[model samples]
Target chain A: MTRVGDVLARCRAEGRAALIGYLPVGYPDVPGSIEAMTAMVEAGVDIVEVGVPYSDPLMDGPVIQYAVETALAGGTRVDDVFTATAAVRDAGAPALVMTYWNLVMRRGVETFASDLAAGGGSGLITPDLIPDEAGDWIASSESHGLDRVFLVAPSSTSERLTRATSACRGFVYAASTMGVTGTRTSVGSAAEGLVARTRAVTDVPVCVGLGVSNGEQAADVARFADGVIVGSALVRCLTEAPTRADGIRALTDLTRELAEGVRARRSTPGGAPGGASGMVASA
Target chain B: MTTPGRFGDFGGRYVPEALIPALEQLDEVRRKAMIDPEFVGELERLHRTYTGRPSILTEVPRFAEHAGGARVILKREDLNHTGSHKINNVLGQALLTKRMGKKRIIAETGAGQHGVAAATAAALLGLDCVVYMGKVDTERQALNVARMRLLGAEVVAVENGSQTLKDAVNEALRDWVANVDDTHYVLGTVTGPHPFPEMVRDFHRVIGIEARAQVLDLVGRLPDVVLACVGGGSNAMGIFHRFLDDTGVRLVGLEAGGAGVTTGRHAARFSAGERGVLHGAFTYVMQDVDGQTVESHSVSAGLDYPSVGPEHSYLLDIGRAEYRPITDVDAMEAFRLLCRTEGIIPAIESAHALAGAIDVGRELGPEAVLLVNLSGRGDKDVHTAAQWFGLLDDAALQSAGAIASADATGVSSLTDGVQV
Candidate 1:
C-alpha cells in the first residue's frame, strides 16, 4: 500500500473520514504556498494535494482558474510542486501531487515518479489522465512505490468505473458533479450513487470531490465517502486574502472546520460511512 | 478507452470522465450514420441543394504567372453556403445532434468561420446555438461574430488563457461537460478527443473526393501537388484524404508563420512543436519545456491555435505528407497577388497555402500542375487585409475620397498628388 493508502487506513481506524485539502503551489509565491500547505497539515488536514498550476486548466472553474493564472504568472515551475510536496510531508501529512498528465509526460513519466517519491510524495491524483491512457503512469508509479489516483464520474460507465477503481492504488477520486471544479451551493445529488457504485467495484477507498466547500458540505460527503477532498474552497482562501499571512490563517481555519466535519460523521449511529466499511473490504 | 480513433499513437480521448459517455454516444451515432443510407442520402441532398456542392474547380492562369508559370487549379470551397469548408462538418454534426435527440448545440471558433457555420446549421435545424469565441478573436473577427449573432446564435467571449482559439476550446469543453445531456458540442475542427478527428474528417472528405474527380476530368491527370493551409487541418485533411493513395501526388500543408518560426510568435506546430496532449488529443503542440502551452500568434485568427490535429502529426511522422511554415509577409503577399492577378480574394488562412504554392511552383517549375484549396473567401478578412495593406489608414481613405471628388466634379486639382 502507498503512504496515502496508509493515511486513509489510519483515518478509518480513527472512525473518521480523511480530510484532503488542496492548494496550488506558487499561488501567491512558491514559499508562501509551501507555508500554507504546512499550515494545513498543522490545522488538521490529513492529506495535502499540491496542485501543479497548468497553463490550460480545462476542468477548473473561475476561482481555481484565477488562482492558476496567478500561480503561472508568479512563475510556478514543476520543481516547485515537489518542493511543496516535501513541505507538506514534513508537516506530518501524506502529500499527493494533483497534476495534468502533460507536465509529467514532459518530465518523462518515470523521472516525474522518481522525483515525487524522492520528495516523499505519497501519490498522484490525475484529473485528466484516466486509466485507459495511464499505462505508462501506472507502471512508473508502481515501480516508484507511489499511488495512482484516477477519478470516476456519474457519467462513467460501470465498465470504466471498475477499470478506473481497479487501477487506483491509494484511493479513487469521485467527482461529485458533472462540471469542473468549483464550490457549489450543494453537491450534486448523483455523488452518493456514484460513490456507492464505485465502492461496489473495488476495495480502494473512494473520496468525493468537485464541489464540497464548507463544514456542512464536507460532513455531507463524509457521510458516504471514505475521504472528503476540497480544492477550490481552500485555494480561494489564498486567492481572496489581503495578505499571505491572512491566507495561511484562512486556510488553517477552513482546514480545521472541514476536518471537524469529516470527524463529526462518526458520532451518528448506523451511519454506514464508507470509511469503516472500506477498511473492512480492503482487509 | 477504445483505440478506434487513434492514428498510430497520436489520437485518443484524453478528456474528463464526464465527457466520456457523450463521446461514446457521439461515436456510436456517427458510425451508424456513416453506414445508414437514409442518413447518407439526406446529407447528400443537403450538400447538393443547400451547400452547392460540386463547388467548382477553377483554373487561374493569371495567378499561376507568379507561381513560376505553373498551372494552378483552385478547389472553390469558398463558394460553399457558409463561405468555407466548415459548413460540411457543422451540418453533419448538427444532423448527428438531431439523431442523438439533443436540443441545443455549442461550438468553439477562432476565425468565426466555424461559429458562423455552426450557427447557420443550428438555425436551419431549429436548435439553440451558442458559440464560444476568444475575446481577442471576437474583436479580430468581429464581422463573423455579428454574422453568427444574426444567424440566431449567442456569442460568448472567452476571456481566459491567452483569449484565443485554445481558450475558446477550453471554455466550450467546460460548457459541454456541464450540459452534455441536452446539448451537443459541435467541435469546430479536426482536433479534440475521440471520434471528433475521425468524424469531422469523414464529413470533409468530400472536398478531396470532388477535387480529385474534377482535376481528372479537367487536367486529364492528377496534379503534381496539392496544397492547403493547416489550422486545425480540416480543409487540408478534407482535400488530402482522397489523394492519400495516389503515390505520385505530393500533399503539403502550409502552417501559419506569424512572423517566422524562430520568432516564438508563430503557429507552426510541426515546425517547432513537441508531441503532447492539448484539447484532448495527443499531437504536435507548441508548449514550453515544462509542458505549459505557449500562446500562438498569427495574422489570420483561424490558424492561431498552438496545436495541430493528431492525424496531421501521424502523417508527418510517416512522411506521407509534408508541412512547412509560411510567414505572415509571404502569406499577405500571396493574398494580394491572388486579388490583383486572379481578381479572387482568398481567406488569409488559405493565403498561407497560396504562399506555399508559390515556393513549390518555383521548385517544380512551369510544367507542374498545383491544386490549391481556396478554403474560404476573404469577405471576412477585408478588415485585416485593409489594415495590412494600409488601405484603411486615413491617408489612403483621404486619397480615395479625393479621387471620388475628382470624378464627381471633373476637377484635376482634387486628384493631384493623391496616392490613389
Candidate 2:
C-alpha cells in the first residue's frame, strides 16, 4: 500500500540505498521467473522492475535485448508482466514496471498505471519518454497511483534537466552517459556530479542508472544517489549463468549485495543518506 | 556443397556459442530455399516482373580503346529498379522474412541506397519496417530518410558512436535481439552472422549469371577479365559470384585507396585491413589493436566502410578473385571518363571498378573483353562530384551543369543505360 518513495525513504532511514533489479517476466520459464522475483526480494532487493515485452526495444543494449527476445519467445506478454508482479504485491514486495514507450503507449497510460499499481508496482520508468514532451501520460499516470519517472543523461542541458526534474514523479533517473545500459566496474564521477545537479533541482529521489553494473559499483553510486538500477548486468546473468536457477540466484543476490554495500558505508565521511518522505516532483 | 565454415581460415564463423544455432538454422534455410521449387519460382517471378532481371550488359568500346583493344563489357545493374544491386539482396531477404512467418523487418543502412531498397521491399511486402541509420548518415542522406518514410519504414536516427554504417549495423542487431520472435533483420550487405554473406551473394549472383552468358553469347568467347568495385563487396560479389568457377576469367575487385596505400583514408579491406569479426561473421576488417573497427574514408560514401564481405575473403584466398585499390582522384577521373567517352554517368562506387579496369585494360591489349558492373547511376554524387571537379567554384563545369547530365541522382536517372 506504500508508495515507491516511501520504501526508498525507509531504506534511507535505515542508512541503505534502494536497489532495483529488472528481470523479464517469463525468463527461463514462468515458474522460474516467479521464483526469481521472489528470490530477488529475499536476497535484499528493495524494488524490482518487471518488463513488459515489446516487438521493438531500440534503447536496450545487447544483453537486455536478448533477454527480451528469450522472454517473449517463452510467451511473456504485457499481461504476464502484471501477472508476475501480482506475487510481489501479495508478498508486500516493492516493484515497478520497466518498459519501452511503445508497449506502454499500446496499453494506454491510465490503464497501464492502474494495472501496474493493482499488481503492486510502486513506480513506472519510461526510459524512452522525456517529460518535456509528455503531456497526457504524465498527468494520467499520477492520477492512477503510478509514479512517472524520467531519465536524464550527462549530456542533458541544465534547462532540460530542470524541466525533467520538475516533470518526474517517483525518482529522477540519472544516466551515466549518452550510451545504452551495460556493464562497467564503476560509475563515472560525472554521474556523481549529474546526481548532485538533479538533487539541487528537486528533493525527489534520484536513481543513477547505466554502468552501475556490479554490487561494488552500485555501492559506489549509492554514495550520492537515492537508488541504483542495474539492468544489463542482471539480464546478462539471467541469460548467461550456467543454470537457470543459478542465473536467477545471481540476479536476486545483486540487490542484497548492492544494498549491504551502501549500508556498510552509511557512517562514512560522505553524506550517508537522504530522507524518503518528500514531495514528488510536480510539474 | 561440401564447403566447410572455414574459408581456409579467412571466412570461418568465429561467433560465440549463443549465435551458432541461429547461424546454422539460417544456413539451412538458405540451403532449403535454393532447392525448393516454389521458392526458386517465386524468386524468378520477382526478378523478372518486379526487379527487371537479366539487366543489360553493354560493351564500352571507347573506354576499351585504352585497353590494348581488349573488349570491355559493362553489366548494367544501375538499370535495376530503385537503382543499385542492393535491391537484389534486400528483396530476397524480405521475401525470406515473410516465408519465415515474421511480420516485422529491421535493417541498417548507410548512404541511403540500401535503406531505400530495404524500405521499398518492406513496403511491397506489407510488413512493418524499422531502419536504424547513424545520425551522421541520416543528416547527410536526408533525402533517404524521406524516401524510407515514403516506403512506410520508421527511420530511427541512431545517435550512438560515430553514427556511420557500422553503428547502424550494431543498432539493427540489437533490435533483432529484442524482437527476434516477430522480427527479421534484413542485413543490407554481405556481412553479419553467416548465411547472410552467402545468402546475399546468391541473391545477387543473377548479375554474374546474366553477364557471363551475355559475354559468351555476344563476344563468342569468355572475357579475359571481370571487374567490380568492393565496399562490403556485394556489387563485386554480384558480378563475380558465378565467375568463381571460371578459371579463364581474370576477376579483379577494386577497393577505394582514398589517397594512396599509406594515406590510410580508404576502404580497402584486403589491401589494408586484417581479418576480423564484424556484423556477425569473420572478414577483412579495418581495425586497430583493441579490435575496434576503424573509420574508413573515401570520396564515395557507399564505399566508406571498414570491412569486406566474408565471401570476398574466401574468394581472395581461394585465388578466385583479386582486390586492389583505386584512389579517390582515380575514381573521379574514371567517373568523368565514362560520362564523357560513353555519355553514361556511373555511381562513384562503381567508378572504382572503372578505374581498375582502365589500369589493367591497357596491359591486356585490344582483344580482351572485361565486364565492369555499372552498379548504380552516379546521380547521388552530383553534389560531391561538383565539389570534386570544382564545378561550383570552377566556371567551366558550373556553366555546363545542366548540359552534362551529372547534376544529381535525378538527372543521372535520365541518361544512357539508365532505367527511369
Candidate 3:
C-alpha cells in the first residue's frame, strides 16, 4: 500500500476519516508556504497536498486563483514544489503534489515522478489529467513507485468511473460538485452519490473535495468519504491574514477544527466505516 | 479519417473529468447532426437566408501593385451577417445547442467578433447568451461589446491572467464546467478539446469550398496559394481544409508577431512555442520552462493568444501547411494599403494574412493567383487602428492632413516642409 493508503487505513482503523489539507507551494513565498503546510501537519492534517501554482488554473475559483496568482507573481518554480513537499514530509505527513497536466508534461512525466519520489512525495492529484489522457503518467508513476490519484465527478459515466478508479493508486478524488474548487456555503448533494458510485467500482478509498472548508463540512463529508480534503478555505487563511504568523495560526486553528470534525464521526455508529472496506465486504 | 478526435498526435480531450461526458455528448451530437439531412438543411438554410453564405470573392488589382503586380483575390467573409467568418461556427453551434435541448449558451472571445456572432445567433434562436471577453479586449473592442449587449447578450470582462483570449477561454471553461447540464459552451475557435477542433473546423469548411468554386468560375482555375491568418486557426482551417487534397495549392498561415518573435512579446506560437497543452488541447503553446503560459502580445486582440489550434501544430509537423510570423507594423501597413487601394477595411487579424500575401506575392510574382481569407471587417478595430497610426492624436492628425494637402498641391518641397 502507498503512504496515502496507509494513512487512510490508519484513519479507518481509528474509526474516523483522514484530514487532507492543501496550500499552494509559494503563496506567501517558498519558505512561508512550506512553513504553513508543516504547521497544518502539526495541527493534525494527515496528508498534505502541495499545490503547484499554474498560469491557468481552470478548475480553481477566485480564492485559489488569487492565491495562485500571488504564488506565480512571486516567481514560484517547479523546483519549489519539491522543496515544499519535502518539508511537508519532514513535518510528518505524506505529501502529494496537486498540479495541472502541462507542468508535469513540460518537466517530462518520468522526470517529475522521480523528482517527487526523491522529495518523499507519496502521490499526485491531477485535476486536469483524466485517465483518458494519462497513459504516460500512469506508466511513469508505476515505474517510479508514486501513486496516481485521478478524480471522478458527478458527471462521470459509469465506464469513465471504472476506468478512473481502476487506474488509481492512492485513492480516488471525488469532486463534491460540478464546479471549480471553492468554499461554497453548502457542499453539493452530489458528493455522496459520486463516492458511492466510485465505491461500487473499486476498493480504493474515495476522498471528497471542492467545498469541504470548515469543521461541520468535514464532519458531513466524513460520514461517507474515506478522507476529507480542504483547499480553498485553508488557502484563504493565508490570503486573508495580515502576516505570516497570523496565516500560520489561522491554518493551525482550521486544521485542528477539521481534524476534530473528522474524528467527530467516530462516536456515531456506522458513520466512518461505511467507506472503502465496508462497501467492498458488503458487495 | 485520421483518428476520432485526433489530428496526428495533437488533439485529444485533456480536460477535467466533468467535461469529458459533455465533450462526448457534443461529439455524438456533432456526428449525428453532420450526417442528418434535416439538420444539415436547416443549417444550410440559415447560412443562405441569414449568414449570406458563399461570401463573395473579390479581386484587388489596385492592392496588387504593392504585391509586385500579382493578382490577389479576397474571400470576403467580412460581408457575412455579423461582419466576420465567426458567424459560420457560432450559427452551427447555436443550431446544435437547440438540438441538444439547451436553453443557454456561453462563449469566449478576443476581439469580440465571435462574441458578436454568437450573440447574434443566440438572439435569433431565443437562447440565453453570455460572452466572456478579456477586460483589455472589452475596452479596446468596446464597440463590439456594446453591439453584443444591444443584441441581448451579457458580456463578461474576464480579469485574470493576461486578460486576453487565453484568460477568457479559461473563464469560459470554468463556467461550462459548472453549468454543463443546461448551457452549451459555444467555443469561438478551432481550439479546445476533441470535437471542438474538428467540429469548429467542419463548420468553417464552407470558406474553402466556396472560394475554390468561385476561383474556378472566375479565374478558370484553383489559386496557386491559399492564405489566412491563424489565431485559433478557425478561418485558416476553414479556408485550408478543402484545398488539402489539392496537391498543387499551397496553404500558408500567418501568425501575429506583436513586435517580433525574438522580442518574446508576440503571439507567434508556431515560431517560438513548443509542444504543450493549453485550453484543453495538446498543441503549440507559448510557455515558460516550467509550463506556465506566457502572455502573448498582439495589436490585434483576436490573434493575441498563447496557443494555436491543435490541427495547426499537426499540419506543421507533417509539412502540409506552412506558418510564418507577421509583425504588427507589417500587418498595420497592409491594413492601410487594403483600405487605401481596395476600399476594404479588413480586420487586423485578417491583415496579418494581407501582410503575408504581400511577401508571397513579391516572391511568386505577377502571374501567381493568391487567395487570402478576409476573415472579418475592421469596424471593431477603428479605435486600435487610430491609435496605432497616431490618427487619434490631434497633432498627428493635423500633420497627416498637412502632408495630404501639401501632396495635393503637387509640391514635394512643401510636403517635406510640412513633415519638418
Candidate 4:
C-alpha cells in the first residue's frame, strides 16, 4: 500500500492537488463501508480517511454524526475499523484513520498505532487533539512509522500554525470554516489566506476540508491547497441513498467529479515545490 | 492550579479546532481576572448585595433525630437568587464575559436551574443570553423555561439525540463554534474542557469558604462528614474544596441511583461507570464495551448525566473523597424528611446528599456532626414530587391546601379586569 506522503508527492508531481475522501468505518456495515471506500478509490480518490465511529462526535455536524451513530449501532468496534482500513488499503488508496482522540487513548496509544500500522494504515488525523497535547501520540506514531496529522483553523495564531505544521508528518488539515463539519453554500474566504499563512511556517502539504461538497468548491480549494478533502458530502450521498448499491454509485460519481475538478486546476501558479520551499526559507 | 489542562488523566481541551483560539483567549482572560482585585471585588459585591451571600448554616435538632440522633448542619445555598448554588458560577462567568467583551452568553440546562441562573446573571450584566434545553426537560420543568424567558433570555428546545441534557450541551457547543467571537458558552457544571472545571470550581468555592467559617463559629469544629450530590460535581466540589485539607472531615459525594446499580439504570459513575471520554472530559462515564456512552437514568433530571466532572474523577482516584449512590426512593424519602422535620423543601438532587448523610450519620454514631449542602430549593420539583407521592389527584391536591378552584368567583373577578 502507498503511504499518504507518496500519494501527495505524486499528486504534486502531476501538477494537481490530491483528492482525499473521508467516510466512517462500518457506516452501512463493515463490508458495506469497505466496498464503498473501494468504489471511491477506483473512482479516483487519492487518499481515504476511514473514521472510527464514536458516540459523541463534537466536531461532526449532522450528516456524518448520523452515519457514525448507525455504524456504531451496527457494532463497528475498533477491530472492525482496522479491518476496514486493511480493506481500503488493499483497494488501492492510502487509508488514514481519522478519529476522536479518546478512541485511541482508551485502547492505549501505542497499541492503537501499532494495530493501525499492521492493518496497512498510512497515518492518523486527530480532529480534537492539538499539537501541544500530542506528546505520547507523537512518540507512538514515530515508533510505529505512521504519519501524524494535526489540524489548523482560521483562528490559529502564527505560533500555533508553526507548531501544528511542525507536528504533522503526512499533511496539515486546514478547516475551511470556523465551525463543525458540514456542507456550506460558500466556503469561508479565510481558507485561502489560512493556507498561505500555513505555507509561510512549513513546507508540509496543506489540505482544506469542512465545506468542500461539490466539484466547483473542490476546484476552488484545489487552486491554493495541496489537497482537497470532502467528507460530509460523500457521507450525505451514502446516507441519502435508498440502497447500499445506490450509495456506492453515488459516492463513486461524486468522487469522480471532485477528482476531475481538482485535476482541472493543472499547475496552479507558484504551486511548484520551489514556491513552498521559498516560503520555508523566508520563515 | 495543579496543571492548566489536566486533572490526573481526566481533563483536557478535546474540542474542535475552531474553538482552540477562543478557549485559549478565555483561559488567558480568566487567569488574569483571578488575580485582579477589581474582578474579585465585583464578584464579591454581587454576592453580598445581589445573591444574599454568606447563606446561613442551620442546625435541625428534629432532622438530626432521623439521622440516628447525630447533629446535622445545612449550608443553605438553596436561598441564593436562583434557588440553587448554580448562581455563583453563573455570576462569575457573566463577569468574565464582560471582561472578554463578549455580548452574548449561551448555555445548556438540564433541570433549568442553571438556565435560570445564567439568565439572571445575563440580565444583571446586561448581556444577550440564549439557553438550550432538552424538549423533555422543558416539559418536566416548564416553570424554569418561563423563568428564563421572563429574565429576557431565549430558550431553544433541543429535540435530537435523546432530547436531554447531553443533547442540549451538544447544541450549545455547536452555537459557540459557529459564533465564538461574540459568544461565551456558560457551561453549567464542573465539566467540559480545561479551565471550565477549574474556573467553575473557583467561582463556587465560596460555598465551602463561608460554610467552613460558619461551621467553625457554630460548632467550634469542622464537620465529621461533608456531603453534596454529584451531578457534574459542581456543588460537591464547591463544598468539598475547603474541607479537603481538613483530614478529619470525610467528603462524601452522593450520585443519583435512579433505580439500582443492579438494574443497569443509574448515574453512579464510580459505582457502575468506566473511564472513558464524553462531553470533552475523560472521566468516569457509563459506557458500553465499545466505548459508546450509555444513557444514565435518574429521577432527578439534574443528576441524569452519564459522565462526571474530571475533578471528581481525580478525587475518587486519589482517595481524597468517597462517592456513593442513593436510590430515588431513599432520596425522595429524605426530601420529605427535610420538609417535615426542618421545614426545608430540598431539591431532589440535593436530597441524594441528605439521604447519604442519614446513612453516614447512622454509621458514625449520634455524636458525629454532618454538614450537607442544600444545593437548591424544591420549588422547581413540585410537579415531579407531586407525582412521586401520588399527590396529583384532586383529593390529594385539596388536602395539600392547593386551592382546587374553591375561590373561582374571586379568580374570575381578577381575570375579568386583566386582558386575555
lDDT of 3 by residue, A1-283 (tens): 7888888888887878899999998889988898899999999999998899999999999999999899899999999998988888888899989999999999998999999999989879999888878888888899888989899999998999999999898889999999999998998889988888888888888899998889998998888888999999999999999988998999999999999999887444644366434534422
lDDT of 3 at B75: 98
Every prediction's TM-score for the first chain? 0.96, 0.90, 0.96, 0.95
Q: Which docking category, incorrect, acceptable, medium or high, applies to candidate 3?
A: medium
User: DockQ rank, highest first?
Assistant: 1, 3, 4, 2
For each prediction in turn, the share of the native Cα contacts (below 8 Å between chains A and B) that it retains comes to: 0.72, 0.03, 0.81, 0.45
lDDT of each: 0.90, 0.74, 0.90, 0.87
- Per-residue lDDT for B204 in model 1? 98
Residue B202 displacement (Å), model 2: 1.0
Chain B alone vs. reference chain B, TM-score for every model: 0.94, 0.89, 0.93, 0.93
- Model 1 chain B poorest ten-residue lDDT run: B406-415
DockQ of each: 0.61, 0.03, 0.60, 0.41
lDDT over C-alpha atoms for residue A25 of model 3: 88
- Candidate 1 wrong stretches, greater than 4 Å: A266-272, A275-277, A281-283, B395-420
Of 1 and 2, the candidate ahead on lDDT is: 1
Worst 10-residue lDDT window for candidate 2 chain A reads: A274-283
lDDT of 1 at B73: 95
Best-first order by lDDT: 3, 1, 4, 2
Candidate 3's displacement at residue B202, Å, is 0.2
